[model samples]
Target: MSHWKHVYEKWRSFEQLDPALKQELDKMADNEKELEDAFYTDLSFGTGGMRGELGPGTNRMNIYTVRKAVNGLADYLVAHVGDARDRGVAVAYDSRFKSQEFAIETAKVLGAYGIKAYVFDTLHPTPLLSFAVRYLKTAAGIMITASHNPPEYNGFKVYNDDGGQIVPDEAHQIIGCIQEVEDELTIPHLQKDELEAQDILNWIGKEIDRAYLDKLAEISKLATGEQQQDKDLQIVFTPLHGTAHDLVLRGLSQLNFHHVDVVEEQAAADPEFSTVKSPNPEEHQAFTMAIELGSQTNADVLIGTDPDADRLGVAAKDSSGHYTVLTGNQLGALMLDYILTHSVSNLPTKARMIKTIVTSELGRKIAADYGVETIDTLTGFKYIGEKIREFESTGETFMFGYEESYGYLIGDFTRDKDAVQAAVLACEMAYYWKRQGKTLFDALHSLYETYGYYLEDMSSLTLKGKEGAEKIAAIMETIRKEPLTEVGGLDVEYVEDYLAGERTVIGTKLKESIELPKENVVKYILGNDSWICLRPSGTEPKIKYYFGVCGSSAQEGQQRLADLKRDMEDVISRVHNV
Candidate 1:
């Protein structure tokens, strides 16, 4: 029998399940299509951890699944240390359906395992939870957030003692424990009130928030009373109906940024994120309302954040006075440039910058211009976080880290991409530029002129269900067997096979070892500073292709990107046998 058949049979015989869950499972009986979609594969646990729709099926995310994961994590932690429970676990949730319930379930599972749980009293951003884990010296941390996914989607993100997501080796162990739990329903959990009574579960309140915000203030660039000349610069921002409503405005006010306009429609924390089709700031439609508000306020800059506020989107007034939504790469490069330029006094010569391998190479040039070194990690924020921990341990300075996905981090207080800190820095940079009688758009164009126009784009081809999984595997196999020697009429200069842990230069016999852990990813570097990478999403059922192009002019860069995208799509289609 297929995976779904087995899962359905097991679920049908399950006793003492919640009525809603039971009903959900019963509805799936004999519904091969839905059942297969839900149970064809296990929820993936990789570098970024797991994210999925919440339901009753084995593959779906639910209370029982949360408990299983937590129990597994508990086992892993206990094995790693004798007093694992004593170090405790910090838990937080964003404003989403069942987010609070899921967080509580995680805490209860830990509590049942005799582990202490420090649960946040209310919704908070993911970065704060990361910071809290390290600040409170917790053994681990958990954040219940779908992070810009639709309202129906939910997820569980696991963090290590260093406040970063569990790396591959640790993730493998956690996955093993999860698989060993033969009976999910039999997992132990403690009642909320009972857990508290035992003094092993503590409810954390505003004090933690205050402390986290205080640290944010330390890195803030607010000018002194008289030096706050840019206080009058008009700025508009929208949280897009997520958890950032109050925290962002509060941070801005604390930094003494006056004339800031918050979009009241998007201010309320709505789990559904009803105002926008998707919470992702990368989509131009996501910024429609914000753009309208920006025009009305004549704002110098506009900013938006995803549901958990871990990534930020930026829109700036261009020379034509029209607001343009900047791509993630553009925003990251602009932020990097601004930080390097303004923080020169505070920056040490040992400062280093980090970007994902797929991120624009313009950032590398900017770092070099500032006499700094730039390192490129894989295509995830966790890799960037790992680099941070590595550098900090070796006594190297971490100036900034960013990905092409609107995630950026400055200070090491948080080990993940921090929209909260990015927002603060964006506003401060806006102020600095405003004082110079220019907008961020002007600065971006200037950089582009000096460093050559760089363009990057991402596309994902999703395949769902059992057949979808098979198709994805076949695609990868075809790529391995018949690698493209050229794309868009450009010769492939280098190929990086992360799975093989080797980067090979074509024709010549040059090969270099990749220090990072191996993953199933393939990247091809073409001539003229153009490249493409293919990798399946660890948490979702999709294969994503990233394209990057650099040229002397914007039009040339765009044309090169378009051609590369077309060629890559052709390769994808052939792999899918479509």
Candidate 2:
């Protein structure tokens, strides 16, 4: 018998299995392929915590699998964190299927281990969960969300004491702890009644919400009285049926932005994301309804947040009288400029903004213009959050942190990418320029005119199941063994192998250790801020090819991007064919 079949049989035979899950198991009893896919491996943590399609299998996300992960977390905290039981953990969830149930299970699992849990009573955004870990001073936090993944998926994100996603080092330790839980069926968890009786499963809200809102207020700059009178500059907002449905609007309202209109079709907490194919804010299709609303209202700007509200996307009226979506890098650069301009008095000497390595250089250049240094982490926002904790002790103030995936963090109140806080700041920034008789599009164009027109694009290839994983690994190995020396008639200046933590200068054997943590990433640098980076998606089953270039004008930038993309696609075909 196959190992996966054995695991499936064992789960099926368990008497205490969830009835719904048992039904699913029974339905797949004769479907060997489905059973194997479902049970081939246990759900594991990626850059985010355990995330997978919801199903009744060891590899899928279900009650048993979720319980196993939470049990491991509880055990890890107990053994490594002093007084962890008393400090406890905070739990929050999004509007995904089974998110609330998973949150409850997380609390019960902690309760079984005598660890207190402060579980939110209603669905909330991911950043709020990060903030709860700090505001509550919990040992750690658990957020039940798959972020911007499709409706069929769900995830478990764990945050350390600093309210940041656990870094690679911490994730490694937690993985080991999870491995120690040999049998998912044997994991123990307290019932809700039992948990309540022991005072281990406390419900929390209201106060944390108030505190987070208050913190947002401190960071949100009020529009000048003249800016306030620019009431004709309408704004369209949409949460895309996610957790920020009310708070983001309330946030804008608190700042006295009363002319805001909402995309009513997507204002509710909908798990299916019925209106959009995917709930991701980064994609243009996600803004279809918002764009319609914006056009109808003649709104000056449009904003959208991902399902968990950790990422925010923006679109504004361009000089062409059409709504153009701003890429994550463009928005980050604009916001950085606004923040610096407004914060000249309060700017620290060593203030800095952080971005992922794959993010465009425009923000870095903008930061430099303001005498602010920009630091690059690997791909994950966890690294940004980790740096925030480090900077706290180093006396370097963290001005902002953003990635090219539309995730932005302005205030340090939340360790993760915070769309709500970003929404507040972005609205203020848009309004500030509105008072100057300009739109965000105009402000963006001014930046490009000052700085060279920088452009970035990425392509992702989806691979599924165990075989797909093998191919992804092979693609990385092939690329690493034979690094590119030139791309699109441009010479590769350096090849940085992040997995080896080494950067090798082209034509020279000279090597320098990379200052960041080692990860399986390969990047090729070209002259003039043109480069290529290939990395596996941390949350999804995909490999990504990122290309960026800059030119004196938009047409030049567009041509360069097309040429680079064409070259990279050829490289991908060669690697995949092998």
Candidate 3:
């Protein structure tokens, strides 16, 4: 029999399988391809932790897989940290299907080892989970979510004692422990009642929520001596039917923003994300309902957040009274500008901004204009979070951190991308511009006029399952072996192979090593300072193309961006054919 067939029979023979998973397995018995995909390999547990479609497989986010992953975490903590049982993991979940169950499983797995678990009583945003780790003084944290993914997806993100996502070094250690497990299906876990009886299952909620909001409010005071008026600036918001609903509402109120309007249709805790095709705020289509509500209410700006509220999307009324959704890059620049301009008294000598390699250079330019240095890390919010901890220890001030995927952080209270804090700060920015008789759209155009028009965009191609994984690897290899000399009719000035940790000059052939940690990414810089980057998604079965170009005018910038995207898409298409 085939390898997958043997594994399938073995799984079917297990007696203690969950009833739902067992039924799913029995129903797909005749589907050979599905079975192979399910049993082909284990779900990846990288720096981002494990994420996949929810189903009954080692490669899925089922109870057994979650338990197995948690078993490794428990062991890693016990083997590495002293007094780990006393310093437990802070666990939180979003509104995704079975998120709560997975969170409970995580606690149970730890409890079986006599480790404490401080779990949130209800669904919460990912950032708050990070905050709870520090606020509750836990050893680590685990967030149950697949931020901005489709309804069928769920994930587990593990954070270290610093409350950021686990760095690669620690992730590898956990993986080593996970590989040592003899049988994931038979991993022993304490029952919920038993865990509570042992006093290792600690439930937390209102106190942490209040603490996060209070810290956010304390850090968001833009003008020191001002009482903060501008309540007339109308705003519309939608949480995209996820965990952010109640806390975001409370956060806005805490910030004293009274003219906020919400999209009731999408304001509830919904696991299916019924109103949209996908829950991601980065997509303009996800802002449709928010834009409608903003138009109806004649609001000055519209803000929408993904399920876990780690990523935020914004739309502002343009000159023609039409709401235009701003790109993540645009929002980042605006927020940086506002932070630097209004927080002069709060600025430290070493204040700086942090962004990923894939993010646009526009924000960097803006920070330069304000004299705040911009730092780049690999493309993950965890890296930015890690930097926050570094800045804390090094005495440098982390003014802001953001990614090009609608994730931003204004304060270091929460390590991950904080859409709730961003929402409040964005509202403050909108009002600041409103007070100047301008909109955020006006501010963006001003920024473009001052610092040449910078346009940014991203394209993602999803390739699923085992064959798709191999195809993605093949595509990456092909590109690395045979580099592109030019793109969009411009000469490739230099190529940065992050996997190889070197930047190669095209004409001189001189190579210099990159200082950042090595990652599987390649970036090509064009003659005109426009750049393109290609990398496989760490959390999803997708490859992404990031494009950025600067031009003397908006029309010219848009044209260049379009040409680059078209050329890159063609290249990807050619690879797909191969």
lDDT per model vs. reference: 0.86, 0.90, 0.90
Q: What is the TM-score (0 to 1) of candidate 2? A: 0.98
lDDT of 2 by residue, 376-426 (tens): 999999999999999978999999999999999988989999999988888
TM-score: model 3 vs. ground truth: 0.98
Instruction: Report how far residue 121 has shifted in candidate 1, in Å.
Output: 0.8
Candidate with the larger TM-score of 1 and 2: 2
- Candidate 1 local Cα displacement, residue 284, angstroms: 1.1
lDDT of 1 at 13: 79
Backbone clashes in candidate 3 total 0
Model 3, span 1-578: residue lDDT tens: 87767777878999988999999998988998898898878888987799999998888889998999999999999999988999899999999999999999999999999999999999999999999998888989999999888888899999999889998899999999998887889999999999999899999969999888888887665554443543677899999998777777787776668888899999998999999988888888888999888878899989998999899999998989999999899999999988888767657889889999999899999888778889999999989988888886798889899989989998888899999989888888898889899999999999999999999999988899998889889989989998999899888999999999999999895999998888999999997769999999998899988999999999999999999999999999999779
Q: Rank candidates, TM-score, best first.
A: 3, 2, 1
